[model samples]
Target: MEFFVEQNSVVRKIWGKSDTVLFIFAGASAEFALNKAVDWLYFTGKLPSDPLGRLFSTVSYARKIVFSSKDDANKAIDTMRKIHATVEENRGAVIPDWAYRDVLFMLIHYSIASYELLEKKLSDAEKEEVYNVFYRVGRRMGLKDLPISYTEWLPVRETHLQENLQKSHYTSDLFKQYKKHLGPIRFKVLIESQKLVVPSIVKKLLYFGVFSLLTPVIPMYKISRLIKLDWVLKSILLPSDYKAQINELDVHSD
Candidate 1:
């Protein structure tokens, strides 16, 4: 529509006149790449919850390698480590290799979309308006319940994730760290007299033909507590406040 074109043009203009150095260093689609990653992982039933901070933190993982920036690279690694731990704890369902590749593809696609937001016209508000459209793109692609992530406005390929995986100890260390945090008794069943097929009712009597009624809510509460806690903590730790990350840079890259 004409409205979109005009809006996009304005947004691109604003970005063009704003800080160029930060734009390039930040990887134009960095936000998009990371958000898409989280979205896909969540949809595939791989990740438990959606937290804006978690998405942002993961991007730092991708930015450092692609952009050749120490700050971005270190930040990205920190995010990867955090997620690796969570994945191990909740990986009750084994995800296929294709799932990881699919996540990577989402990252790449969003990265490009995000970079487009940085052209010469978008204002801070306009950038938000434009990038939100990408979330729609995810919904159309069968990810029905997508989160409203602003990754479409972020730069992409700013850091290389593949390079970070080169660290031999990264995955194991992350898993160990998160597991320790979780403690050994991550999943414990409260049972009076359990039966096969995970029976809803207990098999034995408590006080000679007497028993306490069990509520499903009790176990669901336990699971929710674990998932929600990690989601909140990760979101807080990732994406380091954007205002602090911003600094002066050259008008253009050669």
Candidate 2:
């Protein structure tokens, strides 16, 4: 509870507002509605406005849509329709929920593509194509310009970590949940990121006595990913723009 509060509270303090909320729940819930809630609040008038906030808010709204059921999906679609209408009428956007929904869809699709690759699930040509999409999105999201060759992005022959995973184990449960739901390709991404680390065999052996298992990591990953990366991307927007985008998406009559 404390970790959850701290993690969310930090975003609140960073952005400012108790009215600021994200409705992500675990294992089969009405998360699309939560996405809608984010869409509403963000579109309406209560969240940050910047590349980092846009990325975080986008993922926060997207996470649920990725995990939702058909019924939940329909519910989200209905809610999205209303949100779209509201935002269109508002003339302002920050953390634009529409842009978020787009990015969120790409992330889920990429996770699936990653899974197929990890299990040797895709043929060579298919794999190459899937990887291309990954690079395209990475480029779009401002994750450094995508490489000319998609295959190049895979865990290089060199032993390295996924930048997303190599971090402290602060939000272990959230990270664990992400790993569990991420399936294979996404899991492999985690395996290679800063959010997770491959400890030396000797270290693993030494820790085995105390922990008994490889630490499943993701929450910690989020802890790090949330750090503002605008400086690196040199993203060219102001916080107010993102806040305006979110406000424009707001639709809940409340």
Candidate 3:
């Protein structure tokens, strides 16, 4: 069967690891908090109640599309579109176009950031492939004004970062929820990971010198995975309940 993303794509390799997935969500959590339209998520109350689970569900759907037949992948995309449309209808207003772009761009930027942090740098070709896969998803969802190529996407991504993010009460409350669920130490690590992946504008806005302390460990994570001691790091890093889901991230066929 034909597939939307190639079987051996870099996007598959990136999403196939649990650690990278967690980091992607960590960065997304930071941006999600800063998003002006974050209340759209709050309206459902899912993000506040169980942020990890909510993010994991998104990860799950993403993996499903990456691993499925082209037809099946399109079906999953359709399902996502219908879900968002239903939410908008129920709320009696459309989700903003820029807000939709923000979510899509977050995935694109963080996918590159998280993978490169844990793995080696991706070739420009691999980066283009990553953009292409998600660009297809954006098109299938009927999103307009998406960048025609990955090169064009860079400026648009930057523009979105500048025009779209800020610190608000939602930001504070969401971080509180992160701390409540992750405990203090892990939550700090989450924030540090956010620092590593977020755009420079966001980095300056949410400055903390403490995050630099975690920089040395990024390479160490790569080393541990190579030596099959990745579990030791995960045990120390990930919440126990989410360990299984991380393991499931490795389910893509070799």
Q: Write the per-residue lDDT of candidate 2 for residues 146-165, one digit (tens) a residue.
A: 34553564433112211112
Q: List the residue pairs that clash in candidate 3.
A: none
Cα lDDT for residue 84, model 1? Answer: 51
In terms of lDDT, the best-performing candidate is 3
lDDT of 2 at 33: 19
| Whole-model Cα lDDT of every candidate shown, in order | 0.33, 0.33, 0.86
1 against 3, candidate with superior lDDT: 3
lDDT of 1 by residue, 1-254 (tens): 12212333332332222132223223322222233233334443423322323433444433333333334434554555446556646755443433343344344333333344332233466545444433432332333333354453233212323221221232233234323433343201112111111111112211112332323543453364447553342233223344343311112121
Query: In the order shown, what is each candidate's alpha-carbon RMSD?
Result: 18.7, 18.7, 1.4
Candidate 1: C-alpha RMSD to true structure equals: 18.7
Question: TM-scores of all models?
Answer: 0.28, 0.27, 0.95
Local accuracy of candidate 3 as per-residue lDDT tens digits, 154-225: 999988888888888877888899899999988878888888887777776666453556699877877887
As for TM-score, the candidate ahead, 1 or 3, is 3
Task: Name the TM-score of candidate 3.
Answer: 0.95
Which stretch of 10 consecutive residues in model 2 shows the poorest summed lDDT? 21-30
